[model samples]
Target chain A: MTGYLVAIATLVGIRALLALGLNVQWGFTGLVNLGVVAFFGVGAYTAGLLAVAGVALPAAWAAAIVASALAGALLATVALRLREDYLAIVTLGFGEVLRLFLLNEAWLTRGANGITGIPRPLRSWFPAHYDLFYLGLVLGCVALIYLALERLRRSPFGRALRAIREDETVATVAGKNIVRFKVQAFVIGAAVAGLAGILFGHYLAYIEPNMFVPQETLFVWLALILGGSGNNRGAILGAVVLLGLLEGSRFAKDVIPFLTGVRLAAAQQMLVGLLLVVLMIKRPEGLLPERAP
Target chain B: MAEPLLAVRDVVKRFGGVEALAGCSLDVAAGSITGLIGPNGAGKTTLFNVVSGLTAPEAGRIALGGARIDGRPGHAIARLGLARTFQIPRPLARMTVLENLLVYAPDQAGERLRGLVSRPKTIARQEASIRARANEILRFMELAPLASDPAGTLSGGQKKLLELARALMGDPRIILLDEPGAGVNPTLMRSLVARIRELHARGVTFLLIEHDMDLVTELCDPVIVLAEGRRLVEGPFAEVRRDPRVLEAYLGVPA
Candidate 1:
């Protein structure tokens, strides 16, 4: 039971990182980035491939961050030119395209067979208690990211981003470079998501293209919305609650033996959808709504 | 004669089938409150859009301080010391009233990611100074009491005051205010007029579009009248108001 709890906690920390990234893009900058899973897959693949090739873990992580940030910058340049709603469609398409690339590229991603034997960080040091150490590592990372983001949220750069989100024309006339700020925010958010991917790939010791489906992106969005979109603490809390709901629902199979496999997955998705509807209607700002600064 | 602070020459802009600005030309002298008046569709707003870089002119030259600024992006033009307010007040609605003004402070090093991360102390110091300046501007606009309130919560007249306050935060060389008095209450209108005059006296140049004849007469010298997307007359308000062409543009050929 303790092991199961630790595993769930670790996953919550990982998902929190993703929620924070999306908060920067969607919550703070008003960018609708529906392709978050693409960046996640890029990070996982880049780090997993490099680690399998005997590269240092830190170097692999750095490379993953750079690669994902570049991808984000490229997407922002193309999609931000269109209106906000069109940006959503473009990013959603980009996510599917990336997943297809990962599935078909046999030479690189092993053609959907997935990559295995990816080494874990500091595993040899805590072989008997690796899960606890990994939990600490992930939670430490979440804390660091939360601190950095909170500082940024209170800074002038963040203020400018919020202004751009509120009204692009007003921000432009205020001497803010709208394109530059949006691209930077996108890149920063993508890089953070990439780091989350790296941690997730290492924790699982394997990664498959299917793990980064569009549904995963939706899950992060649900987490962000459940916690509170614009607030960082809300994002972390949301991730914890979301992971709890997901894990707790697993016991439903035992309680009602008729629920199994694909049906269970479908039921989980329905639950998420229902929760979103409730949130939109009753508490659209989420559990921890952003306060005026 | 020195050169005009802002000079728009033979500018043309079109929106699909309609020509919004057709070979329009004008100049705003330094430290002058220049008025741009026209009927509903004479393209006064379009000209402001073109000059402020919100809309690019199809053919023309616009210069500020003798430097061509026709093709530059809006933010770049703004950073070059030109600021403008919208026809309808556009407050950064979610941000606090003070934040709306703080975001407009020029040369904020903390606005960049590198500056933000690398020099925390410097950024904090700069932020404090900017906040002080923002507070002062808020007080001047009589919006100090609402500094912490979300700008969206402000009344329409208050939002207009916030708009002018935001533009003032940037220490702009030239400000293009589109209808500064349109929706403001008369009490607010008087204060707005006094504020514009005060700012102008401090060497700030203003090019304002206003429908209130009394306001324009009291504030503007060298008012420019537009008719059918072109300049019809330019002179003092007293003289320009008496121009037959100006009257024809407003009232439609004396019919």
Candidate 2:
């Protein structure tokens, strides 16, 4: 039970970080970045690849962030020049390409059999602990990232990003480089997802190419939209709540034998999709509307 | 005193075979308040679009500070010291008034990723300067009390003021005001006109579009009229007001 709880906590924490990034990009900038998983996957793979190669934990995590950011910058440079609909198509394709590369690139990524034995952070520094130690490491990082996001949410740059989202033409007339600002927002968002990916890798001690699926990207968007597109606090809470409903439904299947295995997975995804649709219908703004500061 | 800061040379533009502008040209004298006047469908707004690069001319050229900028993007033209206000105010509805100004304020430190990380203090200082400057501009437009308020919360007249203040943030050499008095109350209109006059007095060149003939007569020195996107005449307001073509365009000919 303790291990299960840790797993849930770690998953929610990482997902919260991803949701926050979406809130900034889609919620604030009106950019529909359909390929968020690409960056998150890159970060996880970068960390995983580095850690298994005998790199230190901190350095691996740092490399993951930088690598993810660089990838995000490249993606932004290409994607931002296209119209919004075309951008969506290109990004979706880009994500599939990233997955295919991870699956086939045996030399670097070990292909389908993901790298395992990711070293736990702060393991050597503090020995013989479980809840306190693991929670302190994972949740603490989550908390720190959340606080930083809040700080940025209230900053001038964040405001400009929202402005561009609301009306690109007016922002341009206001002397804002609309494309430049949006690309910056996209890059920053990807970098955050990368950080989350690295955290996830260390927690699992295992990484697989198939693990970073498009479904995970959709889940992050679900959390962002469900919590409240414009609200960061809601984003964190949404991630937790969505995960609870998803994993909790699994325990329900144990009570009912018919809903087992593949059927359960389909049901889980369908429920989320329906929930997203219902949420949009009920309160398109979000579960928690971001209050004007 | 000085050569006109901006010169339009035989500008021609069209929209789907509708000659929105037909060989129209005008000179905006340096630091002087110039007015563009015409009735509805007279291509007054179209001429504004040509100058702002929202619509490029099919022929002719635009010069700012003696350099051609005929086909540049609106933002590029803005960065080149030519700023304009729209007929409709487009304030980033979600952001506060102060934030709207910061996006346009001079960023000597630049907005590089390193500047965000390494020169944090520099960014903060630049932000502070913009806030102070935005407040000053807002106060000048009698909008200081609403500086912290969301720009969308302001009244119609106030939004126009925001539009003007937004242009002022760039510290441009020339500003084109499109229908500054439209939909605003008389009291607010007077205030807006006063602000424009004040900015003009401070050497901000203006090419104003106004339906309020009284305000135009009061504020404008030399008025340029556009009818079907072609220049009709350029002279004193009263002369243009009495010009037979101007009267014929506005009131129509004998039955």
Candidate 3:
């Protein structure tokens, strides 16, 4: 029972990292990146493929980051030209395309049969402490990413990104290369997503094309908006809280009478959507609004 | 005596089939306050937009600092020391006045991905001076009191001031103002005119688009009149005020 709780905690921690990446893009830069799952999947697959092929965990992790960043850069090269809603559509399409590619590409990812036997980091050395070791790893990653995000939000470049979000014209007249700043932000966000993916892949020790679902991307976005879109801490908090609500609510059908499992699941999602609407209507700033002067 | 800071040579703009600027040409000399005066829809703003890289001309060459700048983006033109203000001030509502200034200031060291991972100290070092300078500019614009406020919260006049401050963040030689006095109150408009004159005295150049003839005459050394999207004539404000085309465009009379 304790192990199961720790596993869930690990999931929450990893999802929180993904939420922070989306927050930086959508909240600070006004960039609508709807394809976050693709980057995460890229990192996961990169890490998973390498780990299963006898590579060291650290090296596999390094490959995961490189793969994700490269994917982000490539996506930015093509999709950065889109504006607002168009950007959202293109990103969503790009994620779909990547998912389909993963689904069909058998030579590299073993197609839909999925890849397994992913070696956990330090598993041999800490055999009895596997769950705790992995928990520490995820927590360590979350801490590092959180610190980086906080510094980024306070930096000059981050401020420029927010300014670009407010008004691109103003930024442009002020001598900001609006396009360049945008691409940088998008790529960085994607890289963060990829990092989250690497963590998730190792935790699962299993990889399949379906793991990079569009629903997962939407959930990360929801977590970000829920946590306070522009704020890094808020994003992570939102992810854990929202994912908890989603998973925790499942236990209700077992305890309560007359409620079916499927009904409870549907109810959970509806409640999440309702919470989003209510938040947007009332505060619009999320639980943790952006820190402003 | 010096060559023009901004030269729009025989520019022509067509919207579908309607000719907006028909073979228009104008020269803004270095370190002078020049006014572009015309009635509503006279193509003054369009010409300004085209020159500042918001709109590309169908047939025209724009030269700034003795180099062509017709086909560049607005930011590119801005990087070339040409700044502009929209008729409606477009300050990013979400950012503070200081953040707005920092956004446009050239960032060579902080624009890269590696800057985040490896060059933290360099960015930190660069930002202190940039923030200090931004503070000084905000103070000069009488905006120090509200430097920390969200730019959207400012009054019409202050946002205009914020826009001007944003332009100056760059070392711009020429500024194209699209009706700086349009939404501002009378007193702030006077302050705006004063600021323009003061900046002019400091050797910055301007191509002001103004409907307020009084403000134009007070600050502009030479006023260029436009009608139906083309330059009609250019002369001293007093002379241009008395020009038939100028009067006709304003009052619809042959005064």
lDDT of 2 by residue, A1-293 (tens): 87787778778888998998777788778888788898889999999888888998788889999888888778777877877666677777878899999999899998998888888777787777554577667677778877876666666666667777878877666666777877878877888899888888887889888887788888898898888887888898889989989988888778887888788989998998889889889998787987664
lDDT of 3 at A207: 83
Measured by TM-score, how close is model 1 to the native structure?
0.98
Instruction: State the lDDT of candidate 2 residue by residue for B8-63, as single tens digits.
Output: 88888888988877887788899778889987888888877777777678899889
Residues B168-197 of candidate 1 have per-residue lDDT tens digits of 988999999999998999999999999999
Residues A1-293, model 3: lDDT tens digits: 89878989999998998898887789889998889999899899999998898898788888888888787777776776664567788888889998888889889888898888877777788869689888898889889988887877787778778878887767766667778888788877888888899888888888899988999998998898888979888898899889888888888898889779889978988988898889889978888888863
Residues B38-80, model 3: lDDT tens digits: 8877898889778878778999888999999997887788888
- Give the poorly placed runs of model 2, Cα more than 4 Å off: A119-127, A130-132, A254-266, B12-19, B39-43, B53-59, B108-112, B247-255
Considering lDDT, where higher is better, how would the candidates rank from best to worst?
Answer: 1, 3, 2
| Winner of 2 and 3 under lDDT | 3
Evaluated on chain A only, model 3 obtains a TM-score of 0.96
The lDDT of model 1 is 0.92
Indicate whether candidate 1 or candidate 3 has the larger DockQ.
Answer: 1
Which parts of model 3 have CA positions greater than 4 angstroms off?
A82-84, B116-121, B251-255
Best by TM-score: 1
Model 1: CAPRI class: high
